[model samples]
Target: MKLSALVPLVGVALLTVVLVGGCAATEPTPAAPGGTGDGHGHIEGATEMPEPQLRLVTLDSAGSLTAFDPATEASVSLTDVAGAELLTSDGRYAFAAADARLTIVDTGTWTVPHGDHSHYYLAEPRVVGMIDGGAGAGLGRAASNAALTAVFFPGSGETVVLDGEALGEGEIEELARIEGEPHEGAAVPLGEQVLVSSPDAVQVYSAAGDALGDEQRCEDMRGSGITSVGVVFGCADGALLTVEGEDGVEFERIPYPAGATPAESFANRPGRPDLAAPAGRSGAWLLDTREREWTLIRTEQPLLRAVAVGDSDGRVVAIDALGRIVVLTHEGVQATSEPLLAADLVGAELPAGVVLEVDASRAYVNSPSAGLVHEIDYVDNARLARSLDVEGDASALVEVAR
Candidate 1:
């Protein structure tokens, strides 16, 4: 494999390993029959639009949000995305970052549409809101519910609150601003609360902006011991946060040794052995208060600057730094998607490369230099989709309803 374009990609494997095995007990439903159709012929409750199938959306380097449909493996919608850094979903609206450019598309039209409602939802897509990331700084993350949407800006160390429907295209405002720099972290939304992970601590916050008084501080307080964080993670309430960390993480507070760093905390025994050569700059982590335990999950090396983990067809999809995309599971990591021509995904025309965003069962990869976004179906590890001539370096991605 090409090494230079690969190192930065694996740097995120650090703490992502901790997230793999802690999901709550939901009796696994029998796997759906193979092939694209729901097998119901017309899906039960056909009139109600199937529980929004997840569609991956990514920003091409040229500043456009390319919506990739995983079910049929195609690009359903293409919207202009400028100054977008983060993307998240609640199965309803797709929230983009600071630019306040929220692109809403009907998830139904992307794949097999059962009835006429799918066409109506798509013909008049909604431009929900356009809100600033607080003080004009870019937004790093966003979380939402039926009533409101909360946008977080790590650069400004502030959270901007907004009335979900109040702001739309051409309208902008500075909502409530919360305090604190979200240490190199990943965020998980818990209905009315948001969970954030930092090198030294994990803090919870209320939707109304109150700290939950529960602080689970890590053994190592020093930042240096942490190589990279926010890889991948597993959390309760069906939540997960994955970040990066270093090898042999030894934190003094963990009783390892005085002055031991987080990475030094792990000794000779190998925890995650599947990590490849570029592994360690980052990884995954799994935390569960109910179980009162934290487990480290290993991953391929040189992870992306950030990644969104998703499950589909009994597999996990990962989008790495170089934009290289892959399908992974307990068995192993498999490169199943076609590489993109870098010139199509990024507007500035950098060398061809690939990065991806996975949700539900779809993986959307972008090659900024090639101005293209490729959507892959993890169910069969098939190259089911492709989009061309995209613009902007896609900074983030999320699967949404429409």
Candidate 2:
């Protein structure tokens, strides 16, 4: 129930939370009342409702996005998603598309979009990847290695499967095109079918574009303000999971500790580019769709945006407004309190070369003000493991791999 009790579950120890329930018990200013910025509007009976899912999508104020290899910790990329308003991952690579071309950057390669015209770079997607629809609609997930792309373009109002590998080199072909709007569609390897969702419906399809005839429609969800297609485990209203069932789509909301605010409100920071926090306020609500009943995960940090790394067993990492990094594990939230190396782990004065690169990892901290990249090693509670210097304005750090 407290920070100390949460240590073992998080795989980290000794986290000191100064404030418990002791501060002025006064309600949070509606501006400051503790709640997620999902744009779900205040619910009258939400006070007694269960906590839903907690999914944090973080972004950097420095005009960059965070992409990580949740599997190996060996790779991470802080990319510029073509000045995208939001960044969401299919748990493997990061997606940023502009115009008709959807650029898929391998976190391992950290390839930059070149010349604004080039198509095939040295970088490659691992499975199936595709960019559907245009801006303000939704972007579908791409499986790096697969040759297919699960896409939904608003113009067509359908989810299309195209040969991703065959897309660039003048050999474009549509393998399967199913009927649906380009709300927000993410691919999940559910045996032989792909589950896709719009703001109003859920449709299941075969890998080869065959409609499985399984559909779940929600009549009451007309303008829930959720415009994006649903991922395997996407976000929903108030710490809940938006699931598709035989009957219809169900919102399995959870119940957590909710704090109310007074008429005089306070906000953490407005216009933050986080999926969990959105653009209006601070704080985030994370929901794990990978699980059946979406579990509500809460945090105090101002999450900007996030990238779900599939390589790391569906691990998700987020960056806060202050450029701090927080990772999601099977248990709970674990923050990088120290740097990367054992020597620079914790309790040591932050040495030169250790700059937290916006919101990637404490392992690589970049202080543009100082023009240095500190190699961080977070051990006990300290943030810097070891600081190392790098080139550039420290303006941005992208994973450039060979």
The C-alpha stretches of model 2 lying farther than 4 A from their native spots are 1-96, 104-147, 154-158, 163-173, 182-191, 218-231, 235-302, 306-317, 326-382, 385-402
lDDT of 1 by residue, 1-402 (tens): 211111111112221222225543655444433332221122111232334544556655455666655555566555665655556544445655535334433233222233443311122234444545445444555554333456555555566555433332213343345666644343444434554455456566655666766665542322111111221222121122322125311112212123211221110001111111112344332222223233333555433322323222123454444444555554555554453432343432223223344444455555544445566666675465656333345444555553
For candidate 2, give the lDDT of residue 141: 34
Q: Tell me how far the alpha carbon of residue 212 in candidate 1 is from the true structure, in angstroms, after superposition.
A: 3.3
Which ranges of candidate 1 are over 4 A from the true structure? 1-47, 50-91, 98-123, 134-136, 145-148, 162-176, 186-188, 196-199, 218-314, 319-324, 334-355, 359-361, 381-397
What TM-score does each of the candidates earn? 0.52, 0.42
lDDT of 1: 0.40
Most lDDT-accurate candidate: 1
Among these predictions, the greatest TM-score belongs to 1
Clashes of each: 95, 89
